[model samples]
Target: MSKVIFITGGSSGIGKSIGEFLSEKGYVVYGTSRNPDNMKNHPFNLVALDVTNPKSISNAIAEVITKEGRLDVLVNNAGMGITGPIEDTPTDEMRKVFDTNLFGAIDVAKAVLPIMRNQKSGLIINVTSIAGYMGLPYRGIYSATKGALELVTEAMSMETKRFGINVTNVAPGDFATSIASGRYHTPIFENSAYKENYQLNLDLMDAHVDEGGDPIEMAKTVYEIINTKNPKLHYKVGDFMQKFSIVLKRILPDRMYEKLLMNHYKL
Candidate 1:
């Protein structure tokens, strides 16, 4: 029997790639997006889903369950980014980011847990970022959202392990995705403090993402994990720079790490 997999944010970027990859591998992939018409048809099913809305989440799941009796995998990949200095970001916008990235994942997991628990077997993969592990200047709010996901995935892994379910958190470094460009940004005060410095940090981060790793690499990693009999709790995928950044965070002193980031960003 073919395994059924449900994916959120499957319209573009890494989610789209992962959906396509898994479907080709013979999994019954059910992907979700806010606008299903915009998504190009693949080998799997596409359903309308909006993570921020509980009704939308429930309806999508119901539709899938109605068609397929069992779900073998759930990939919580739907997320948005908010880039700006922490102090400059409005509280409303910050909350919106978390609503989509963190709470959204939780909502999906909550809805799917019962089915997985009843089945006594399943895998949940949360698509986090390197920001989940380390914070960056100007992108503090975005980092916080991913950080929340990382911690949630950790606790979820422990809680679900005994139930025969696996929860894996994937923290990919800068990938060639539309996240940097497609992110919704609110303008900071034109004459406010840190405007110049904040702009500089945003520019640097954008440049790095423009020249980052391939999305297909991350997609391949997701496919590999899904095929594994026993998936691990966490995985990191990126180029050499990302690996080095993780290492620096591990060994370097706090002040030294801050200094390194400052120099790297040319702040």
Candidate 2:
């Protein structure tokens, strides 16, 4: 039987790319968006789903299972971004980012775990970020969300091990996508403490992100993970420098690492 796959946030970006790529690979694919109308022209099945809503998550999974005998893979790729200093970011705004990036992914995983547990085989890949390993200016909250998700993936690996379920946290540095268009930037004023360097930080952040590698590269990585007999706990997709930074942080002293980041951001 062909493998069955379900992807969240499939309207565009990494999610959509993965869905399309995997479909071409001959798997049964179901991609979800809160507004399926937005994806009407897409080739694969498009289901209306809201990751932040439990009922919507449950229903989407049910739709996939009802149509396909079993779900072989669940890719939690739906996420949102927030920018600006933490102090400038409102509490409610942080909550919104966390809801979509972290909590929502958690809920969707919970919704699918039961089905996989019963089947005794499945793979859960949560798309995290390279920022999760290091804190970045103007994107602190976004970093926190990814960091928390990575930790959750670690704990979950152990929790679902006995059930023959696989969980891997895929941390991407930056991929060419519509992510910048969806960011919730914190309000900044003329008198703001970060005003002088705010725009520069934002520019630096954007420059790298805008230059991010193609999303198909990540989709290919996901494909490899799916076919591999034993996938590792974590996989990172991005530029060499970004991946190197993870290693540098590990070996370099704390102050040294912070200095490197400060210089790179021109702070």
Query: Number of clashing residue pairs in every model?
Result: 0, 0
Candidate 2, position 22, lDDT: 95
Expressed as tens digits, the lDDT of each residue in 154-203 for candidate 1 is 89999988998999988888877888867867586798688888777778
Assess the local accuracy of residue 57 in candidate 2 as a C-alpha lDDT between 0 and 100.
Answer: 93
Candidate 2 residue lDDT tens string, 56-171: 99899999988887999999999999998877779999999999999999999999999999999999999999999988888889999999999999999999999999999889
lDDT of each: 0.87, 0.91
- Which pairs of residues collide in candidate 1? none
* Poorest lDDT segment (10 consecutive residues) of candidate 2: 37-46
Give the C-alpha miss distance for residue 235 in model 2, angstroms. 0.4
Q: Which ten residues in a row have the lowest lDDT in candidate 1?
A: 36-45
